[model samples]
Target: MATIKDVARAAGVSTATVSRVLNDHPSVTAESRERVLAAVERLAYHPNAAARTLRSADVTTLGLVIGDVLNPFFTELARAVEDEARAHGYYVITGNADEDPRRQDEYLDILLEQRVAGLLLCPTDRVSPLVEEVVRRGRPIVLIDRSIDGLDLPVVRSDNATATRELVDHLVALGHRRIAIISGPTSLVTGRERLAAFRAALAAHGLEVADRDVRIGDFQTASGVAAMGELMERPDPPTAVFAADNLMALGALRWVRDRGLRPGSDIGLASFDDLPWFEFVDPPITAVRQQTEEMGRAAVRELIALLNGRPARSRTLPCQLVIRGSCGERQGAQ
Candidate 1:
C-alpha cells in the first residue's frame, strides 16, 4: 500500500503539503490540492482515519443532538449542519432526542462517549446535569434551535418573541380579537417565549387573553388536535387559532376539518414554523418562516469557532411572516 510519503513524491510536493491537502487546510492552493488529490487517487493512498485520530489525540467529528428528528424542521437543520461540517472537513454524528429530556440525556452521554470534538444540541430541557458536566470539562458546545438558561454557551435560534408578535399583529389587523392559541410546552424556551409574545401582543391591542382560549401543547400534532378540539367545543369559540409549531397547526387543521369548519372562513389559522407542504395545503397556511437552514449553518460555525479557541457568540435570526389564505387575509375556496 502507498503511504503519505509516496503520494507526496508522486504529486511533487512536500509530505506536509500533502497532509494539509488531505486535511482540507484553507491555505492550500487549489492547484496544489488538485494535484495531491489526483496523486492520491492514482496511488490508491487511503489514510487510516482511526490511526490518525488516535495519534493526534483529537476528534474530527461533531455530535449533533436534535430535539426531534421526525420534525421536518429538525431534519432540515441536521442536513444543513452535515453539509457545512463536511465542507470544513469534519463529520457529524446525529441523534434524535424525540422531545424527551431523558432521551436527550442518553444521547448526550452516547455522544460524549464517542469523544466528539464538539457538540451541537437542541436541548429538550433548560438544564441538564450531563450537559453541565460536559461544560465543566471544557468541551466545546453550541446550542441550536433551543437553549437552556444559566448555561454559558453559544446558541443559534430564531427570534421567537418577535415572530410571535408579527403573527399576532397580522391576526389583529384582520380584525381578530377573540383569538385562541395552541402553545408548546412551557419547559421549552421557544414555547414559553412564543406564548408570552402572543399575550403581550394582545395586551398591546387592548385585548386580554381568556383562560378558555389558551391550550398548552407539547409541540406535537396530537396535542394540537386535542387543544383545537377543546377550544372549538367551548360555548364561545375563538374566531382565529394560532398553533405554536407546524405539527400542531396540522393537528388543528384536522380538528377543524372534523368539525366541518372551513379554515380562513369559519375560522382563521396560523402557525409558527412554515413548511413547503403548508403552501400546497387546501388553504395555504400563514406562518412564521424561520431560517432553519441558516440556524444549522450558524450552529456549526459557532461550534467550529469554539473548537478553534475563538470566541463564539449566540445569534438569533429573524423569521418571516408568510401570508396565506389560512389566516383569513385572502378570500379563497376550500
Candidate 2:
C-alpha cells in the first residue's frame, strides 16, 4: 500500500508538506500542491479513513507511546498515565518504542490508524514526521518525559538540570574529586541536559571534566555495565560514578559487585532516577527522585486541555535528591 510517507518521498517533500497539500491548507504553495497531487496520483495513495474520522468523532481514547517498557521509570510512568486517564473517563492504548526511532514511528502510525483522539509520546532522540503532521492537523499531541528540538509541543518532565546539579554537589561534598558519569544517549533532551548539568556542576567546584570521564550509554542496563567496566579499567579510575538513569545504575551496581568492590567503601555510586528498590539495595543508592506520577497526570491534563480546544502549556516538575548510603559521608568534622 502507498502510505503518506511514500507520497512524500515521491513528491520530494516532508510528510507535513504532503499533508498540507492534500488538505488544501492555505499556506501550501500552488507549485508544491501540484507536485504533491501528482505524486499522490502516481503512487495511487489513499489517506487512511480512520485518520479523517479522528477529527470528526469524540474519541475518549488516547495513544501513549513510551521509549522503553522494560525500564522501571517508564513502567511507573505508564501506570500513572493509565490511572489518570481512567479517572478522566478515558482509556489509553500504549505502545513501547524500546528506544528505537523506527519502532517509535511505527507505533505512531498504528495509534493514528486506530483513531486515537490524542497522543502522549515519550519520543526517541529524533522527531517523527507523522507526529509533526498530527500537530499541523491541530490534533492534540503531548510530550512525556522527553522533548524534541524545533517542536513547540506541550511537554511534562522533570527539572533535570537542577537535580543533576544537586547530585553532583552531594558527590563532591563526599570528597570525591575523580568523578565519572554514565550518561544516556545525547539525542534525548533528558540525556543532553543531565550531562551538561553534570559538567557545569563539576566546573563550579573547580573540577575539570576529562573526556575519558564521560561514557555514553543507551539508557539500558547492559550499556551501563559496559560503560562502568570501561571507566573502572582506566589507569586513574574515578572514585565516584554517576549513572543517568535507574536501569543503568542497576548495571553499574552489578558491575561493582562482580568485581568484589563495595559501593560506598571502595567507590561511590549515585543515579538520576530513584526507584523503590534503590533503598533496599545492600548499600542504598543515592538518587534523584522525579515525580513520575505527577509527570504522567500532568501530561494527560495538558492533552485533555488541547482536546477541549484550550491552550496547553508545557510543565517542568521538580525532582528531589534522596541521600543514601551508596555515597558515604566524608570524614567527620561535625
Candidate 3:
C-alpha cells in the first residue's frame, strides 16, 4: 500500500505538510497543498484511518474538548460546533473533560498527536499548561465557554455575569429577597463569573448575602441535589433558588421532589440552560438561555477565518433570560 512517507517524498515536502494537504487543512498554503494532493493522486495513496489518526491522520476534522458533555449546555454546544464544522467540510471529535484539569490535559495531548487541523476547548483553570503545549506544537485553538487565563488564544463565550445578574434582578422584582445560588466548579471562568454576579446582585439590592445561601459543586444533578438539601436544612432557607446550569437544575428538581416539596409553588426555582422537559414539569422553570447553537456557529466561523489567515476577535455572545413559572413571577404582570 502507498504510504504518507511515499507521498511526502514524491511531493518533496515534510510528512506533516503532506498530511495537512491530504486533510485539506485551511491553514495550508494553496501552492504547497496542491503539490501534496497531486503526489497523493499520482501515488494512488489512501490513508489507514486508525493508524493515520494517530500521527499521519490528515482528515478534515476539529477536536472539541469540553468540561461536561452530559450537561445540556455543553451537549448543545457540541451539536452546534458539529453542525457548523460539517458545513465547512470538516467533522469533529469530541471529548469530555469532566471539569478535571488532568483529563483536559490528556485529551489535548491526544488530539494534537492525531494532528487535528484545529481544536476548541472549554478549559479548567488548570488549562494554562495545555494551552501552552498546543501553542508550542503550533496547533490552532479556539477556547470556548471558558477562557484559559494567561493564554492568548481566541475565545468564544457567553456573558455569564450579565445573565446571572439579570436573573437575580427578575427574582428580586418578584418580591423574593432571599435568593440562593447553586454554582458549578470555580476553576472555570464561567462558573466563577456567574457566582460573582449572583453575589453582586444581592449587594446591588442592598441585601445581605449569607454564606449559607450559596453552594459550590460540579454542575452535575447530584451536586444540585446536595446543595438544595443543604439550603433546605437551614433554619431560614431561601424562598427562591437559582440553579446555575441545566444539570444542577435537574438535581434541584429531584431533591425538591424527594422532599415532597413543591418546586414552583413552595420554593421558587429559576435555572440557567433550559431543557426540553422544562415545560413538561408541573410548572416550567425559568432560565437564562445561552445561545449555544449560535455561539457554536460563531466560534466555528471565527476558527475557520483564523485557519484561512484572517483575524478573529475573542467573542462573547449575549444571553437571553427566559421567564417561566418557576421563578414565581408571572410574565408581563408589572
Quantify all predictions' global Cα lDDT against the true fold: 0.91, 0.91, 0.85
Residue 135 local lDDT, model 3 = 80
Question: Model 1, 176: alpha-carbon shift in Å?
Answer: 0.8
Quote the RMSD, in angstroms, for model 3. 6.1
Highest-TM-score candidate: 1
TM-score winner between 1 and 2, please give it. Answer: 1
Give stretches of model 1 more than 4 Å off: 1-55, 331-334
Candidate 1 has an lDDT of 0.91
Residue 30 of model 2, lDDT score: 84
Please report the TM-score between candidate 3 and the true structure. Answer: 0.83
For all predicted structures, in order, the TM-scores are: 0.85, 0.82, 0.83
lDDT tens digits, residues 265-333, model 1?
Answer: 889999999999988877788899999999999999999999899999999999998889897867332
Better of 2 and 3 by lDDT: 2
How many pairs collide in each candidate, listed in order? 0, 0, 1
